[model samples]
Target: MSFHFEYPRTIAARRPGEFKPAAPKFHVRWQAPVTTIVSDYIAVQRQASDMAAERAFFQRMRRAFDSAYGPDSFEEMRQTDEAGMVNSIVVAYWTDIVRYALWKHVDSFNAWFRSTEREQEAVGYWRETLTVPYDRMETIFSEPYYHAGLARTRQAALEPMYTAGYFGAMRDRLPISAIDPLNSPYGETTPEGNYAGGPVRRVRVDVPPNVVSIRSGQVWQKAEGEQLDDYYQNLQPKLETGMAYLKEHPETTGYLSLRAIVHLDKDGQELRETSKHGYFLALAQLERWAAEHKSHLDIFKHALAMRRKYGADRQVVTWHEVFVLGTTPSLEYINCHPGTGLLRFANVWGNPPPSN
Candidate 1:
């Protein structure tokens, strides 16, 4: 017999009036000249066997992050997989690129990378540094009362643009060639694309004493021919359904704090694989949700069944990482819409209230 479990209404849902809009305006901002350090630490060798070593590597990096940038730096949310894996990412933002360059050359930072013992460990590391100038980027916060991402920089806000709809909309302002080269591997023809617009979706659920905030990021890739058709027709709907399911059933899905779906884009620069990352309140909560949630299990089984029918070559998960992180209290937000980025966590993280 099939089992159906009913979930109670979450606190936020019960008292919708109490969860008032902190910031209703859409604030726009340009990316300033800053250094962004992207690091991926993976347990590639003994991925399944060396759990202890994988954890140790994470702890070592956490200590390094605390000692180096601490609270002053803009640290984005760390992403991790729901399916257990010893793969994680740490993204640190620095307003002064020069300082970051100098710190890399310092003895302590230099020694950590060069240590033979660390090099031979089961984990593998990859790093990239990007110096983004003011015009090269753009950011928007639908609810300005909460701060996060570039909002932590305290940059000034400009009026929002109708064209500024999605995560990569700013890429449109860049030279078209930067996105799709004339001599492309996918083909010489431009690929079909779609962008979902409007404000970032924020779902706040209050489970009595504990209140959880859920945010989303949608990163789409250009695809050609049948692949593109399948993405829009088949995969896209399923994804939308999943998102709706979470929104409708917050009591069961409350454990999920963040969900980002990134499509593979090897032909273009950066992020080469298609993957999903979900952040939970804690590792224990994630484990329990993964094991007990019926909707989650159905989706997991559907993915496996699809892979079996389509074959592994047709569906490849190149690489995935999962990270559990604590909130950085020292981060700053200036003239930002109160509802941006990690600022959504201000109340939960013990930060001061947003100044309208």
Candidate 2:
């Protein structure tokens, strides 16, 4: 199904947060020196003996990336070969934080990991890491979808809601301690509803336009036998539960709209020189026939609200640096229907991109 959004205001905060740093998904595969089970086990055992050293090295590495590339630096997209012998690929969202860090450090990282010292210490845990930046990776698109739809008639006059009531109401959801007009990016304003609160949860607004895009990151630290066993044991059940929930509520059901993002570009002058990825075509509409389905819409809103509250801390496996700042209160906007014709606006890149 196809959807459209229109707004009189050119600047309005979004649900969950005004702006989220782009975190492209990733898939990494490296060539291991020992593919055989005995050799691989022996290598892992050696690495296991020195897991602390690797972790400490990565901690320092992460700090450097944060200092030089910013928090969203490692939000690269990753994929593993579902088929045999395919090269593993990493598809990262191209942000300055990511670009600079990868451009500067990836080669160095490869050199270090493959050095005789590291390989001898931690076998089988890593091969050589390869990276491929993607405009929009497929893993995210393959997941179930959730979002709001909004449309306003053309006659709606554009205005700036940068400091309007909507923002104030959803102030709690802002990422920063508070909205500092002098320093913060406009997109990082209060309206975005922290990292989790959306229009329904934070402020009074129409249902947001469908979620056309998303980016995310994950990290797996090297661990030894006992540590790995304990960690995975604790993690697997949660992952299983979450997967079960998604399986039960697949995108094909409910008020869901799925889009294939075709293009992505960084915030820049002239705008044209920035990155361009792909176009989106709606693949399914769970709410297509139910234009007036408030119940189904509420279901999605409820799920998101819960996710914002619990997913990040307990269920989700995510990179460590990024955090949810605040959330918008769950509130709804009531539209006084006009004489049939309604105002509409198009999808736009909200605020300026986060400065790395």
Candidate 3:
């Protein structure tokens, strides 16, 4: 790997001769290592036919989350998955897992989640959370700009990345990958959903080994005038198109599930911010898609163009957190439309590259 300067790290362990990335990039450095970080994605959804009810449920939950975690930052987003369901999501992050535990038990929030009324409503509810140790997560940044996503540390720093922007780079960036091949399991990949048109069927998913999940965030809130127009008119639309492809062709791309989300306000209304949280069977599959897919390549080119134009003054921030989850990632959906997120490959999905 090649770097123009040196900086502290908030990335995974590095490897040997065959391990070091020949093409170097940049990443972030947190204040200190977080032993465990918990990310919770709370989603409230309903069918396209029940738009009014769904928005109501979304606002109610948003109010509940705001009251439960007053000072902490909770990012809100909207998702339309492949199930023909409209979902409103609130993403909460806890650097210390213990704090998350306290928040989870908040009386009002818990009551809402456990209430019998939820079974009666047309709206569906789901939360897909994953708690991972420090070593399992890998992060990278193109420039020393914004600390988007989980990199929102108290005072984050930026460092050079030796292993990124190329094929097999994610595996090289992961410290655990040095020892564990981080491959996916091969087994029965059938789903287990009670799709009998019930309003209260809750299914808990068992995450297969080495399943790679990523939260790629892009915030154009700081852009203005021409930059703003470019982002909304060209950049963001491109991102949405790519996300749709990933959602539609999961088997071809090794993407089990994907969500293109827009930010929400206190009133649960959508804003300019956006992000994509995706899941793949293995790190290698994700890398292949990023490095080989034309869809991703277009996104990559547009990013470079914007970065070059603005240089350090760029208001647009792009970042992503890549985590190879340990088994038992918490993925649950209640009354959700069928085939919602990781549900498609319920019985231990494996990481086999799509047929060429």
**Which prediction has the highest TM-score against the true structure?**
3
Residue 134, model 1, lDDT: 33
- Compared with the true structure, model 3 gives a TM-score of 0.78
How does model 3 fare in lDDT?
Answer: 0.68
Give Cα-based local distance difference scores for all models.
0.35, 0.23, 0.68
Query: Model 3, range 213-326, lDDT digits (tens) per residue?
Result: 898888777789998899889888788778777766655566777777877776666766777888877776666677788878889889778766877777777778888998
Candidate number of the best lDDT: 3
Which residue pairs in candidate 3 have backbone atoms (N, alpha carbon, C) closer than 3 angstroms, thus clashing? 13-175
Question: In terms of lDDT, which candidate is stronger, 1 or 3?
Answer: 3
TM-score of each prediction: 0.37, 0.24, 0.78
Q: Residues 325-352, candidate 2, lDDT per residue (tens digit)?
A: 1121111111211100010101122222
The C-alpha local distance difference test score for the whole of candidate 2 amounts to 0.23
Q: Candidate 3 at 24: error in angstroms?
A: 9.0
Model 1: lDDT to the true structure: 0.35
Per-candidate alpha-carbon RMSD to the true structure: 22.3, 22.5, 6.9
Question: For residue 158, what is the lDDT in candidate 1?
Answer: 43
